[model samples]
Target: MNKTNSTKKTSKVGIVGGGVAGSTIALRLAEIGVEVVLFEEGASLVNGPPICHLHAGGNLYREISDQQCVDLLKQSIDTLRVFPHTANIRPTVIAVPKRDKGEPDALLSRLELLRNTYHSLIESDANNKVLGEPSDYFKLYDQDTLIELASRDFPSTPSSLDDWMIPVAKNLNLDEFKYPLVLVQEYGLSVFRIAATASLALSQMSHCKVLTTAKVNHLEQCESTSQWNVHYQQFDSTLGDWVTGYEHVDYLINACGYKTGTLDNLAKLPRERMVEFKAAYVTHWEHSQGTWPEVIFHGERGTPNGMAQLTPYPDGYFQLHGMTEDITLFPKGLVSSTAANAQPELSAPFIKKLTQHWQQDEVDLRSARAINHMAQFIPEFSSATIGGKPLFGAQQIPGTDPSLRAVDISFDGINYARTEIVKASSALSAADAVVDKLQKLQLITNDQHTSLELSFPITRSLTLEQVENFAEQLAEQRHYPSALARRVAF
Candidate 1:
C-alpha cells in the first residue's frame, strides 16, 4: 500500500456511527486532510440546550492535579469558558468518612499517615512539577484538623469512604482555595447540542458526505483484490421507502457501540467469540438549586462490588449512578422487556443500598428518572480448556433458581468470528493503556476503584498474536487505547 496514494485514492473513509467517538475522530481526520464519509442510521435531532452531563467513569481529567487543573482551566477558557450563554460551574465535594464504632480514631490516624505520604510523594521530584509549588493550595490536615474546620462550618460524621476522601480533599486543598469547581456559571447555550451539530458541520466542512437514516447491511470482500464493498440501506423520503446500494472502501471502522450485529455480518466473525453486557443509567433527581460538586465521588465499599458515582453539574442537578455488577438480573438472551421490567422494586433497593453505603441522606426518590434501562452485554472469548480438552459448545447450566446460558468456542475459531470483536477487544486494549497511564499518575487505581480485570470469559478461538497484541497494548497503555495513526497501517 503506497502511503501517498492511500491518501489520494478516493480515500473515502466510512464511519458507521455519528456519536461522540465518531465525531471526534472524523474532525481530527478531516483536519489532517483525510477524505471521510460518515453514515448515521438515525435522523439528526437538535440536541437540547447544553446541560452539564458527567463524563464516563474513570475519566482522569476530572481531578484537580496541577496539570489536570491547568488543562481543564485552559480547555474551559478556550472551549467552555464563556459563561451565562454557556453553562460552566464547578462544585465542591464534601467527603464524610463512615467507619465502624471506635474505628474513627484509627482511621483518622491512618488518614494522617496517608496524607503525609501523599504530600511527600507530591513534593518528590517526579511529582513535584505536577503538584506545583505546595502552598496553602495543597495543604495537609489530619482528621481532627479537617473536623475542626468542618465543625466551624458544616459538621458531619465520618464514614470509611469519607476518611479516604478527606485526605484526598485536604491534600488537594479543596477548602479555602477558590478552585474552578467553586464557581457556578454557564459558559454557553446548547453546548451539547453544539457538539452534535458540530459533527454535521464538520462533515460538511471537511467535504465529507454524511448519509443519515442509512443502515449498513453487509460487506462484500474480494479475495483477489483484498478490497471491500459496503452495502447499506437508505430510506427514501420521497418514495417513503428504503433503497439499497453499495460503496467501496479500503477499511471499515466500527464506531457502533454494543451493536455488533451489523459488523458481525459484515466481518463474518463467529458469534461465540464476542460477548455483550448491559449497563443502566438512572437519574434520580434534578438539581434545582446549588452548584455541582467539584470532586465527583466514585468509590467502592471495601470490595470491588458496589460502584456508585455522584456528578453535580452547574444546572444544580446531580446525577447519581449505581455501579456496574454482574448479577442474574435479566434473562440470558438479548435482554428483553420482561427481564428489564421484571424488577421495578430493585430500583429503590439499589438506591438505598448505595445511599446507605455512602451514608448520604435519602435523595428524593420521587425525582427518579431512568434512561437506557436496557441490559448491556459484553463479549469475551474462551482461550483454553482444562487438561487440553477442546471446549466447543453452548451449555445451559441450572443454578439454585434461574438457568444461565454459557457458550464455549474452540481457541481455533475466534478469527472466524466477527472482526468487530477483534477491533473492539483491540480498542479496549488501547483504552486500558490510557487507564494505566493515569494510574501511574496516581489519578486512578485500577481493580480497586475501577474494574479493569477481565470478568468475561475468553474464547479459545482468538489467536496468540491477537490476544498478546491486545494484552500488550492494554498493559502498555494501562486502560487507554492507542490512536489510529499509531495503531493502524494507513
Candidate 2:
C-alpha cells in the first residue's frame, strides 16, 4: 500500500459508498460550497444502482418511529423535486390481482393500514367509499365489474382522478390470468438516470472532490478538536497499487450503505441501523408497444416468493425485484473484518437459505417450511429470520373458510426502499443535519451564491463515438452529463 495526502481541512466531508445516498449527500453539500470527498468502493454513481414518486418501498408505508428518520425522508422528497432527472420519474401502478374475492379486501385493508401512517389523506371510507388506493381504485370497481373488466384487454386510462392517480383496466392478460386486478397509482423511479443526472450536476459545481477508488478503513473522532479522521485506501491506476490515507473533517456523515453498522461482533450495523438486502432479476422480451408502467403484483402466479416488482423500461427490458426487511443479512456474534471468505459461525447456512430465497427454489419454493428447516438446522439466524413486518393474513386465510377470506396485502421492497425518492429524501435530510452540525461549529458563512440552477442544455449533443467515450468517462471518472443531454439532442 502507498500513502497519499489531501489538503488538511477541519470541515471537509468523507462519504463512503457511491450509491444514491452517497451521491445525493455529495451533490447537495457541494452545491452549498462544502468541500466533499466522496469515496466509493464502486466505479460510478448508478454503477451500484435508481426514482419515482410516492412511497416506492413497502417499509416506507410502515412506521419509522424515529422522528429524525421521518424528517430525513421528508427533506429527501423535497430535495428531489429540484433535480432535473426527477422529471423523468413517472407514476407507478401497484396491482393486486387476487385469485379470490377476499384477497382484494385484505389488500385494501392493508393499504388502509398504510394510510394510517400518514394523517393528511384521511377519508370517510363509508361503504369503502374512499379507501385511498389512489382515487379509491378498489372501491370503484366491484367484483362483477372487475371480473367483467378482466375478461377484456388491458383497458386504457379511465376517466378518473387524472392528476395524481390513474386507474387501470382489470383485463390485463385476460384469458391467461383471470384475477381481479386492483391497482393504485404510486411513483416509480429510474435510479440509473437519477445517478447519471446527479453526476452531471456534480460536474457543474467545482467545489466538490469525488474519489471513486478509495475504500474507507474506519471512523474516529478526536477528543481534543472534535475533528473526525476518515481513513481510506486508494489505488493508483497508473502504478496499479493501493494507497492509504485519511481526511480530517469536523463533521462526518456515514452514507456507507449497509456495511457501517456494528453490534458486538457483526459484519454490519445492527438491525435498527436502517439496513436491508434486496435482490432483482432482469429479463428482456419483445413488446409491440411502450408506455407501460412499473407494476407491483401480489397474490399472483408469478410471485410465489413474497411480492415481485415488474418495472418495464422503454428500451424493452423489465426488472423483477424482491424486497424484505434485512434483519437476517447480518448475523450477530460474527466479527466484522475485511477478509472475504472468512465468516462467522452461522454465515454459511444463512447465506444458503438467503440465496435459496432469492432464487425461488422449485423444490422448496423458498417458503416458511424451508426457512423453518434452516432455522432448525442452524439456529443462528433464528432471531435474524424474524424481523419483517407482518402483512396480517398476507399469505393465507384468516381462520376458517379459506375460500371466503382474502390474503393479506403484500409488496416488494429493495432493501428498505432504495429508490431515488427515498434515497434523495433520506440523504438530503442527513445532509441538512450535517449542515446544522457545521453551522453549530461555524465552518461556513451565511451565503455565497448557493442557489445553483440545474439545467440540461438542449444544444449539447454527442456522436455515437462520443457517447461511448462519454459513457466510459462516466463510469471511470464518476461524472455524468446533464439530464437534458438526451432530451433535445439532434
Candidate 3:
C-alpha cells in the first residue's frame, strides 16, 4: 500500500467504485476544479480487466427523449472522435421487418411505410450529422430482394406492437414503427468501456486523483471539523494489505452502482429500503454475411422471458442478455463465477428463438459469429430492497409501485430544507448538514402543497416514480435531497 497526502482546501470528493457512475462523476467534479479522489476495489483503468464484452449501441435510447437521444448521440460521437481506437465504435443500425403468416402484403406495405418514416427521420437535421453522408451507409433492400439472394428463404415472423412498445421500445420511440437499420454503424464495444473512457477523459482534464485496489471499510464523522474521515484498505500484488485513513470535504457522492448496498452500512437507512435487479447476458453466433439488424426486439422475443436484451456487437458477436429481475441471480461471488463459465447454454436457446423468428422472415443467421458469453446484474429499485432481497409488494405506497420505489426525507423543524447532500460520507453530523444547505441556498422552500420545485432548467428523462426512488436512495444514504429542490407552489 502507498500513501499520498494532499492538504488542499478545495472540496475533496472520494468516489467509491471506478465503474461508469463513479468515474463519470469523478471526472465531472475534477473538471470543475474540485479535489477528487477515485477509489476502486479492482485495478485502475490500465490494469483492470475489460469491464464487459457487450457493446452499447442503444446509446440513442436509454432513459432520455428523442431530442435528448439526438443530443446524446452527438455528444457520444464527439467524445469518441477524440480517441483513435474508437473508430470501431461508430454507429450502425439494421432494420428487420416482421410479418404475420397470412399478411405478407400487409407486412410489405408496413415495411415501406416504416422505411419511409425512418428515412425521413434519419434525413432530418437532428440525425444528419451522426448519419454522415446518408448515401454511404443507408441503403434499403426490399424483402423480395433480400430473399432472392439468400440460399434459404421463408416469410417474416408474426409481429405485434403492443407488447413490443409498452416498455423498452416505447422508451426509445422504436415501438412506433417497424424498420430496418434505423441507424447502425460501429460504436464503442461495451457500455463499461464508454463509461470508463468518459471517466478517464474527465480525470485527465480535472487533475483528480484515482486510487485503485482501495476498498472503503467504513466512514466516520468528525465533530470538530464537520468533515468526513474515511477508513479504507488498499491491496497490491507486490505489497501486503495496507490499511489507511483519509479525510475529505463534508460532501460525499455515492456512485457505487450495484454495490450501493454498501452505502446502507455507512448511513442511517436500513438495507431493505433498496432493491436489486439482475440483467443476465449470453453469447451466440449468426452468419457474418448478414447485416446486423437495427430494430432491437423489445417484447418477450426481443427481450426474452420479460427481462433480457439480444443485442448485436461488432465483429460478428452477439450478446443475449436475460431479463432484469430480482438481484438474487447476483448472490455473493456469482458475478465472477458466471463470467468464468461462459457457455452457449446460457444464451443459445434464447438467441436461437430470436433467429428462428428472423429465419421465418428469410433472414440469414450464419452471418453472425459468437466470440464470448457473459452475464451481469444491475441494482434497480434501489430504494426498495433489503439485504439483497426485495421488500413485500404489499408495503408499497399506492401510487408508487414497489417495482419502482423511492425515498424522501425532510428535516422536522426547517421551514425549507436547505442542505448540501452527500452519500457514503462520514461528514453528516445533523440533518441540517445535509438538508440545511438546500434550504439556505433557497433551493427548497416551505409550501403548503408540495415540498419542492425546480427553479432552473433540469433536463432528465426519469419518470416521476424513478426520480422518487432515486431521491429515496439518496435519503436512505443520509444524503440531503438526492435531486435538485423544486418549489411546490401554494
Tell me the lDDT of model 1 at 439: 38
Better of 1 and 3 by lDDT: 3
The sequence of per-residue lDDT tens digits that candidate 1 reaches over residues 1-490 is 1223223434445666654334433443443335566666756411111123211111222222333223232233222211111222222242322311222122233323433443464555232222122221222334455544433322132222233234233333333222222111112122233233334346345445677787888877777654568789999999999999877754445444334334644566323222222222223233122222333222242223322334432222223333333321112322211222211122334333322321222222211211121101000101101111010111111111111211111111121211121111122232233233333533333333211211111121233334334433432332212210011100
Q: Give me the candidate number with maximum lDDT.
A: 2
| Candidate 3 Cα outliers beyond 4 Å, as residue runs | 1-9, 45-128, 131-192, 195-206, 223-226, 269-287, 290-295, 301-310, 313-315, 322-490
Cα RMSD (Å) between model 3 and the true structure? Answer: 17.2
* lDDT (Cα, tens digit) per residue for candidate 2, span 300-324: 2222333445454443444444333
- Of the two candidates 2 and 3, the one with more favorable lDDT, higher being better, is 2
Candidate 3 lDDT over residue span 27-142, tens digit each: 43443344667777755431111222212222222222333233233333333322222223233333332321121232233334433433554565343333344333233334
Question: Per-model C-alpha lDDT, please?
Answer: 0.32, 0.40, 0.33
Worst 10 residues of 3 by lDDT: 385-394
